[model samples]
Target chain A: MSLTNDRIKQRLIEKFGEPVSGFEELYGLLSFEAPKEMNLKILQFLFDDDELKFRFLTDLCAVNYPDDKGRELAVVYHLHNLVDNIRLRFKVFTNVQEPDVFTASKLFSSANWMERETYDFFGVNFIGHPNLKRILNVDEMDYFPLRKEYPLEDQTRIDKDDAMFGRGGTIV
Target chain B: MSEHQHHIKLPEGSIEKQTTTLNLGPTHPATHGVFQNILELDGERIVSSEQTVGYIHRAFEKLAERRPLYQITPITDRLNYCSSPLNNMGWHITCEKLLNIQTPKRVDYLRVIIMELARIADHLICNSIVGVDAGAFTGFVYVMEYRELIYEIYEEVCGSRLTTNIGRIGGFERNFSNTAFEKLEKFLREYPKVLKEFENLFTRNRIFMDRLVGTGAISAERALNYGFTGPNLRAAGVDYDVRVHAPYSSYQDFDFIVPVGNTGDNYDRFLVRNEEMWQSLSIIEQAYRKVQEFKGADAEVFHANVPEYYLPEKKEVYTKMEALIWHFKIIMGETAIPKGEVYNAVEGANGELGFYLISDGGRTPYRLHFRRPCFIYYQAYGELTKGAMLSDAIITMSSLNLIAGELDA
Candidate 1:
């Protein structure tokens, strides 16, 4: 039998009750959020459940939301159940000041580098990560580049004009 | 015996031997791209390995946040330059999904043709490079000529060779030229003989087989746990393909087989890619036939009627005021976008190339994350190459086909 989003939602709700919220089906993808602490438990449940065998960790990344107080960094996990060929997204948000979420490297080996990348870019401290330092970026770099706090373009570049690039220009 | 007697007696197995630390590359010729691998070697065998990427990190995601939707296509081009049309099409499809633009069947067929050609080009490079790495230089040069032919087809279609920013969100920027079809036909005819010859050169060759057959084998379970996809996972014996599982761009209409291999070794990866090239050729042929069958208005239509997003033609832009205004608006990203988050995946030459897009009803994306397959799969290199011979490790890296641009992006 093919796994439907509704069944998965019901299972998640039954297992973790109030902790799991924001159940949404955006463009046919089931997405929801849980408390940062329950990330491992929810992932384990999703993996261990016979009906919801989302064993494949399709993607793991963190998105920084600077404006959202106490929920500044969202670590998103895209999981796929190969048997049913279905995919669902699980997300957990944490405060930017104390962005500590348990790692899922033990559950999915793919998470090791991905978590390191998450740490490298968004500075989401993945607690329990065996070798969490930096994956893609240089170790000498101090700040997280992906966080909304940094400007997209190099602020120091004087050669390029902002008006020419359509940044400050008004469309005629 | 006199010298040994002079020294203190040592306990059995207590003598320490230092493993040589060899740095393979961030610029070595054998690496094919800029990636560093520090290997601890016990003679010719690798004891442990550590991979370092980000030599070409351009912060594409960060760049995407600042650029308008249409302008981001060029950034996608740099991700996998070997099969850039696939990346372009993937980004376009993601944008189309976000905007809820339904492309026509003819457009879908056109996309499939371009994507398959890109797949062929990508696989040709990967397979031939594996040959090159395995000391069969002739096969690499032979397949490269065919890759140039594929590039000609791309050039004819998009006016660019390597990093082809091919299509628009709604559909193609323009209609496929007659010369493009001619080039495609020429490629379709000539590539097969070259591919067959190339395969014959390496497939049964005892040296190539011996080097690759048992080298860098990853179990299916470990591959899945490590989020392997496309040919690598398929080579590991799992029959999961994004095209078959989740049909996009008229992939469902066509008939093709997803090839699988047993051991997920370098040889299996080579074989799986070779078979996929054949499948991609068939798919393009079928798509081309379907495209030819379209009559009258359906035949002439290329880009969809979404003027707000799709730029107007050059002639129309010069002649009409509204056309000029709409073109400027689209280019400037003045058009309002829907507030939503959408995840779209296309079967890139490597694997499931996915884009997670979030829009806040603004011209620019709120956040965009690209699920680059190479970046995900390259994580297992340390595990795969551990305890393997140094020569075998080189072949393993080549077989994985890790493009540094995609890896670091």
Candidate 2:
């Protein structure tokens, strides 16, 4: 029961109108790049299509395509269909200045944390996410740790002056 | 306004109270890691619990970028140290897929043997930690003792119990030691008895049930939605397992049951894991049989495409000049690894442990992402712990079986 890549591509194209430019299909993984504007609608199609009911939102993450000329930030979503057991991937290419994509947190509540994580590290903001706070980093942390611009070596020093774990930082 | 540690419950605050804050950890023993959780409490119940990670972040992903795929096995050691072999093997497999390396059948069997051992070791620790959190001190010690025995087998096989750099690009760096197999046979014989003891002690006990029943209950709908894998998702009645749902590392040949739970409660999750340990033992038994069955067969000979990545054999290096030069080249990691991206998910003891590696025609991977099970489970932590009692929080969190190493990594 090996699922070939061609089957997923044919189904996806038939469901959502022609994908944005630079859509490529690999072995068993499907990847398509959509402009930041059309991400919500394409996601809606994926959720609505009976054949490709990607009910299970497996993973929502972002990667910085720093060197890519046309766009800078690529927000990739690795979604899986629970009933069919096929995986589909869709990404949005947004510029570095305003890395905003509509939040799919309403569709999958788990997206709430992942979006916050993407925001914390890559500075990609989910437009309508209810609580978009830094997940991996502290509240006071100003920089996103996962971004390429951020220093590779963490500069936050552990303080030894407080009674409640440390001094400089209030236990939060 | 709470005063002393005793009766530390929140004062008469309204559910609508916006400013009431509750500090959960960093110093608290509940948070297993050197981690902190701050909660905005609303009268004895949590309004919001915000987790602050990077307290134990060691820049592992960044460190992987500096080394070749072979050398990065040690760094994977820290990601899931409880199941370092699983992490080590996962990294190697992903690199192999990118380089299109096919390992020998004997090596595949060897891989299964070690992975099953690591799985049992990891599950033992995870289940015992649940006991530790539940105040069953004696159970934790017993489980740890058995885990130490598993470590003994690991030590004999790879010379290190924690960070086992066993697999090369194409095959294992060396043959399995005879002493290790003998030790494993003895351990397998006794492990079931100890596991039965564990089930007798905690799985059916009323006190344990009180702490776990209905605590941290997540429905199948919610579990699947959050990318929850492994026991957490299975506990919610989802039969999906990476080994079965998506097989890798010759897992297709092996037969194992994907246990599912009904309620998604702490107890059900515990049941799933307990049964899972029993299942893991069976898997190891079968894996061992396969190892014995395929002893001298030349099942595979396809070397990984990145020739400069794998270390050459001792005989080859001593006799052949090209092999000697290749060994030196591999030492420097001056290999032209292809520009490819692959995502490999392994059914680790705790959950679905996946590695997303994007190599850019270089020796080292350009980007490496870990689809950690604990992280996914912890995302639902607030929903899991919201109205449950403080004791339930400890037990339920334990039942979720989230290792802090995997969570933070």
Candidate 3:
């Protein structure tokens, strides 16, 4: 039989136990979250496993949740098992203040730039990344732009009102 | 010798610096896009190269978080402008997937035709540009006419050309006009002959073959590890096409081959793209035939029946109350979006263009990340070009089809 979500979940539960939580299949994609420190360990397990040959690193990015205090940032990895034709999402949450997650670049070389991009946008500060500098944004940039704290529009602009724009008002 | 040394008293470290550091581009014509490669070279051979991108970083993902569903299509268009329709379609499909909207058969087939045309246009540019990089400009000049014909077909479907904001959230903004079908028919009747001629010009040409055959080759293993997808992966002999593996927009209904090459070199990439153009043509023909088989009312169906997201007719909006309210709600971005996360990918001209969208029942996405294939695989450029000749690096970059906008976005 082809690798199903239950089977993958079973394997992860077998290996990582209860720490691998929030298993849900939405829009046919199986998603689960793990502890921030176990990111590389899980990635390596997924790569080294015989049955779960999720070799292709489809995408890597970060999502910011300003309200989720202890876990303010989520680094999402989209891994594809080309042989079984299954895709899964693995996420690890970290606090914004110390957002240091182990890098996956050692396992997947493509993750080098992606991790850099994540660091640039969300300030993930991937630990042990070979060149963990900004990939897309300029180096002189101070704050992470994609974080929810940073609004898309300029705060200093006096002409436009945020209330009229329909997103809750910050306009004078 | 002592008198000559005294006459030209060189700096202490001048003779020890054996390699030259050359900046390939941020604006060089040969680089094709706004990308810079700082190459450490030993004479004409590259020692090690470092690439610096993000010249056109438009903060698209950040912008996407604020825009509603329909407004994001134009942002996708700028991702891979060479085949903007494909990007537009990919984004719309992502939205549709999140909303759980089912499209009609005619709309699916219509999408297939436009998307296949886009694939052909994209492959034409990459392959012909490969020829140009290899110093064969005639093929580029010849194939561009057909690309223009393809553009005319796009013009008939959508109003614009290059960065075409083509399709809507669920389907096309309008139906395919007769002129569009005629233009497609004209292209179909004429393009095969031109493609054959293009192939004849480059496939076996001694100079073109020599420049591309073995240079800049990446093994299938490395290509996958480096996240290579679409033609670049196919060129390395892995037939992992998004259209074939995960069929979308009625792609499973059509019959087409996923053409692959053996070596993963510049020549293989060129050949793979060229063969894919042929496959795209065949797929377009099948979709067109399937579209024609739709009888009566089915023929007129273009967009899906999702009034909540899709806009009503302008005349109806002006005349009727409900249409006006719906129109206003959609324009004002007040439509209720479902709370979910969905990832949708399409076989773009170069690679797999994926949209990872997360919506928290908000007007805009909670977080939206574009899995631009160019950006993912472009990290391999340093490895791909290491120890190769400077000119071959140019060929490899063009063969890789790295779009700067997509890369930096």
Task: Select the stronger candidate by TM-score from 1 and 2.
Answer: 1
lDDT of 3 by residue, B72-95 (tens): 888999999999999998988888
DockQ of each: 0.55, 0.24, 0.69
Residue ranges of candidate 3 with Cα displaced over 4 Å: A156-172, B1-12
lDDT per residue as tens, model 2, B214-331: 7789999888777788888898999988787777777887878888998998888878888888777887888778777753544333233345667887899999998999987777
Segments in model 1 whose C-alpha atoms lie over 4 Å from true places: A154-172, B1-17
Interface residue Cα RMSD of candidate 3 after superposition = 1.7
- Relative to the unseen true structure, what is the C-alpha lDDT of residue B143 in candidate 3, on a scale of 0 to 100? 92
Cα misplacement distance, residue A37 of candidate 2 (Å): 1.4
DockQ order of candidates, top first? 3, 1, 2
Residue B49 of model 3, lDDT score: 90
Q: Chain B TM-score of all predictions, in order?
A: 0.96, 0.90, 0.97
What TM-score between 0 and 1 does chain B of candidate 1 receive? 0.96
Which candidate has the top score in TM-score? 3
lDDT of each: 0.91, 0.74, 0.91
The TM-score each candidate achieves on chain A is 0.90, 0.79, 0.92
